[model samples]
Target: MSPEAGTGSPIGGTLPRPRSPATRDLGMRASLLFPDREVAERYYLPLIYTACRTCYSELEPQEIFDRATSGRVTTDKQQDLIRRVIESGHGSTIEHIVFTFAISGVTRTLSHQLVRHRAGVAFDQQSQRYLDYKRPSYMVPGTIADAPVEVRERYLAEMDESLAFYGEMLEAGIPGEDARFVMPNATRTNLIMTANLRSLIHMSGLRLCTMAQWEIRRLFQLIRHEIFTVSPFLGSFLAPKCVPLGYCDEDRNRDEHCPIRPHKDNVLAAWAEKRAAAKAKGREVPTL
Candidate 1:
């Protein structure tokens, strides 16, 4: 359960928006499509340079893109300078380098957590209303599937019942939107996501949190896997939110378990302890 959204509760009226479930690249590759390594190595930095410069310089956007994409500007220099600004949280520079993933086999439950990102990311999911599936499927979590055989059977039975009901609802001339009310959280879907580096980091932070739902966390695992395929350097940035933030803010982490990173409270406590120790030496630590 995601404490961020009040215990990963049923999305219900809280998330009124409907989205297409994307599921094209689950076990598949996100690399075989747009912005191949050649393009990324060549025009990517320049394209970003153009985007960043357009807002500041008198030159036209295409001219900037040309300067960056063409041999007029060097790629390493552009990337090096962009890294500094990105580190400083000057996010606009990253809006230029968008990665599109051919995402597949994720559930509607995960998608709700996904589309909450409002800035610098765009998603187009496959429509449920139009996709009259010959065979609609759902996922079974390992915990549930690995349960007692009868329990697993009961779980799958519920999923099958839900899918069967969805089809029956459609046959009864029910609207897809309302008919989808019968769909299980396990229903598989696909999407294509284009996110700037900043939003990508932000989403990775939340979804990668130990307290986040397993489905969304697994989706990020897939995203990281996809990123790793293209460039390990870039993939290095895709990690649990705490890896970059230096502390875990997820409320569920107050237990101090999941020790990949220290809880934010523990960090504060350590700082306080260190500050008291410094005061014993008659030197007070200055507030930032």
Candidate 2:
């Protein structure tokens, strides 16, 4: 649980709409393949609400789940409790639910970063070692695509040459495990990732930020959309870290150029001013 969660403040109050990049058709996709909308609507909330309710209720877990799922507890009440428990930094309550995504056509560069998250998450990626490529496609970043004609042409030609050589190596009886050494980071791959709610929110906080790599940020954007389609309430929790922190912490944003939130320095400066004013009035305020 984040320190900000202990404040019991709703971080999703006004999440800036994620930027819609022009990379939509670039062969990338994130589909929530499990826990479809019906399941999410019927079981997900009840499960989380039951977990939260179990903490302070005398009712048995089974009875609580039954009441929640049977509509004995109204949806609004369940959501309200969930919102409060989550905002109260009781993260384990929400870990009972999980989401699985079928992610495809992202670059190796992005997949490398994606798999680094190890807690409360599981992933099985397409194996480059077992599969042989036939007309394998690669990604051309917006920067490279929009470069001068000669630079763009050279980039494409280099990619084509690399794949052509990979094919020749395979035909010459090189194992894919050995031949994939030539595959550029731009080569596309697929993965199936399942993460509990807590881990999903944590990953989203890091990956959905403006300071994140553009391709991976776009991937999380697509993932956030998938979560939104199934349950907007759950999706609301997916946001950049600064949203929850109520200030930006990235050193790159020290200049406060991104504007999503004030820098931590500025927030602390304001806090100090308030504290000093209270002291001058012969009163003291609690320290952060």
Model 2: residue 253 alpha-carbon error in angstroms: 0.5
Q: lDDT by residue for model 1 over 1-288, one digit each (tens)? A: 110111112212332212211222233223325566776767666766676667678988988777777777676666666666656677776666778888776667777788888988888998887776657766655445335667656776788888888878878888777787877777777888888777887888888776777667767777776666665556667788788678888888888788888889999999999999999999968987
Give TM per candidate: 0.76, 0.91
Q: Give the total clashing residue pairs for model 1.
A: 11
Q: Pick the candidate with the highest TM-score.
A: 2
TM-score of 2: 0.91
lDDT of 2 by residue, 5-50 (tens): 0112223223233344433356688999988999999999999999
- Candidates in order have lDDT scores of 0.69, 0.85
Query: Where does model 1 exceed 4 Å of error?
Result: 1-32, 48-79, 172-178
